[model samples]
Target: MKHRRSIELQPPAGYAIETERQALATLPQWFVMHARCRACRHQTPIERRDVIRRCGDTLSLATLARRLTCRGCGNRSGNLLLLEKLPRD
Candidate 1:
């Protein structure tokens, strides 16, 4: 049977993240990267590794946002949301 899971969104202040690079370094192997274009509101989901490979490991989250382009609108400006998976059962 396939496993199921749910995400618990708590307060951000509960945890301490010193830097963007530091946070990305601790992400799981299979995290989802949510990219959205500000101009056209275009959004896309990409794998963590693919983003890293495309943007390079040395780039920070801010740099990654600037690097990625929207395929739907061909815009360079966008935001990124990093999501991690949690097992429920």
Candidate 2:
């Protein structure tokens, strides 16, 4: 089946080393060094199912990428703390 890509070029279809680097650049050293949730200030693994549940299915690495919205605050991570890490290729 053909995968779908969002306008921003993210969504399983968005996996690219450069794209991942750009995504990582948006984050701070503390986030990459320490690693934590941009939402609720919760320091946890992004791989956790609950985190995925909170961020919605589109945030998944399995997908290309999408706008991350918090279920609790109804806020987007684009505005919230963007704690990003470079994915190893």
Candidate 3:
């Protein structure tokens, strides 16, 4: 008999993703990225292709967060990036 190790679906608290590859590894096709503003509690979906195109694949999430601005409040402070799985049809 053979056994396979279970994969971790969720990241631990204060988990820092150093690169896009680390964050996207084993991510399902239904999962999409979003940026949530801490100051105003605003959330918006982000296109992964566009981000990779603009920032390249090696950019860290922390650095990307610092680069993003809240569209709702026009705040320049860092926003939280999240990977949310969408419902299937």
Which candidate has the top score in TM-score? 3
Clashes of 3: 0
lDDT at position 52, candidate 2: 39
How does residue 6 of candidate 1 score in lDDT?
A: 45
Q: Of the pair 2 and 3, which is ahead by TM-score?
A: 3
Sorting all predicted structures by TM-score, with the top scorer first, yields 3, 1, 2
* Candidate 1 per-residue lDDT over residues 1-89, each given as its tens digit: 22355444553463433335644546554445677777777777767776567656665665566677878877775455445444435
Best by lDDT: 3
Superposed model 1: Cα runs more than 4 Å off: 1-9, 12-19, 28-31, 78-89
Please list all clashing residue pairs in model 3, or write none if there are none: none
TM-score of each: 0.58, 0.23, 0.60
- Shift in Å, residue 9, candidate 2: 32
lDDT values for all models: 0.59, 0.39, 0.70
Write the number of the candidate with greater TM-score, choosing between 1 and 2. Answer: 1
